[model samples]
Target: MKQTVQLAGLSCQNCVKHTTAAFSKLEGVESVTIDLDQQLAQVTTDTAYQVQDYQEVLGPLPYKVESVL
Candidate 1:
């Protein structure tokens, strides 16, 4: 499964790094790509993974997830 999420309030690459680290810790996550200029992240994971599961990963961030697709 793949998920693309829009994020708000990420100001720099460090924010991207933080977000990537958080998602990478999830059990099934295979890859994470953050487009800091666009404030979006694309995550690729196993078939069993669900986007809802990532909510927990983003919960502590300064940015809020704007959408998931």
Candidate 2:
């Protein structure tokens, strides 16, 4: 499955890198692409995962998952 996650607090390439790394670490996530300009992430996963699950993984970070679709 593929998910497009709207994010907040993303301002630079470093933020993109961190967000990519965070999502990429998820067990079922196959890949992560972060767009700093849009402040969003495109995540591809092999298993079913919910918005809350994504949010939880980013809980420790400064960034927040605004929405997921």
Candidate 3:
């Protein structure tokens, strides 16, 4: 499964690193890539992951998930 999570408040590579780390820790997550130009995180997973599941992992960050596309 693949998802593009639109994020707000991200302005640097550290944000990408943080987002990648968080999502990578989720169960069945295979990969995470952030596109700073689009303010989106492209995630690849092995399980049926839901939108809220992504939010849950990112909840503690300063960045906010705008949507899942």
- TM per model? 0.82, 0.88, 0.87
Show model 2 residue runs off by greater than 4 Å. Answer: none
Highest-lDDT candidate: 3
The candidate that achieves the highest TM-score relative to the unseen native structure: 2
**lDDT score of model 1?**
0.82
Off by over 4 Å in 3: none
The residue pairs that clash in candidate 1, if any, are: none
**Candidate 2 residue pairs in backbone clash:** none
Reference-based lDDT, each prediction: 0.82, 0.85, 0.85
Of models 1 and 3, which has the larger lDDT? Answer: 3
Clashes of each: 0, 0, 0
Query: How high is the lDDT of residue 42 in model 1?
Result: 92
- Better model by lDDT: candidate 2 vs candidate 3: 3
Worst 10 residues of 3 by lDDT: 46-55
lDDT of 1 by residue, 1-69 (tens): 888887789999899899999889988789999999998889898744445666677777887777778
lDDT of the structure predicted as candidate 3: 0.85
Candidate 3 local lDDT, residue 30: 90
Question: Would you list the rank order by lDDT, best first?
Answer: 3, 2, 1
What TM-score does structure 2 among the candidates reach?
Answer: 0.88
lDDT of candidate 2 over 1-69, digit per residue (tens):
888998999888888887788888899899998888898788999876677887788768898888888
